[model samples]
Target: MASQAMKITLERIALFQFTPTHCAQARAMLGWSVEELSREAGVSVEAIERFEAKREVLDVTRLTLAYRFEAEGLVFFPGFAPGRGMNVKGSTPNPMARADFAMVE
Candidate 1:
């Protein structure tokens, strides 16, 4: 008997570019075996093995999956806060705004 073809999604496609280091973190942090990571991520064990054993980078298309991996709170890069570089979300405070306000024609 033949196996049915598997379907791939954009998110799954993005993880292809991930470095083996990233995948190893994901597996270790999530307490998952290679098979478990493959099942949860909808990727194949072969791909996971390639990354883990060979340390080869996955394809570029797989990069997008990094966010998804982060969403799981697995092994998103450390020291990277989503808003680290961006301004705070709340309204900005500036008492000097009114004092510095000047109308120029």
Candidate 2:
């Protein structure tokens, strides 16, 4: 079951496209440098810079980068409708956290 799920994920990732802006945004949200992302994504810093500059990268490289970013809590939303973009999971305040804060106050 896990292998099947991973296969489906890989298939989806193969078809997904990421823009330079999305990469930049995700990096900024994580406060990660190009070198840092390169290390995590197992790609070269030069490749990351070129992708950001040209808004183009090989599908495998792009998927690698995306998966790396996602592993670090970044969620990528497909541009199927409005408000399509990346966001950091748990970056927003949760109700439980808010309640804890209220108790503290």
How close to the true structure is residue 65 of candidate 1, measured as C-alpha lDDT?
30
lDDT of 2: 0.60
Residue range 55-105, candidate 2, lDDT tens digits: 555655665666566556556556621122355532222322222222210
Clash number for each model: 10, 0
Clashing pairs in 2: none
Each prediction's Cα lDDT score?
0.44, 0.60
The best candidate by lDDT is 2
Error of 2 at 90 (Å): 14
TM-score of each: 0.45, 0.59
Residue lDDT tens for model 1, 30-97: 67887776555555677667656755544431342344354454333333322211332211122113
Per-residue lDDT for 52 in model 1? 65
Roughly what TM-score does model 2 have, to 2 decimal places? 0.59
- lDDT for 67 in candidate 1 is 42
RMSD for each of the candidates: 20.2, 12.4
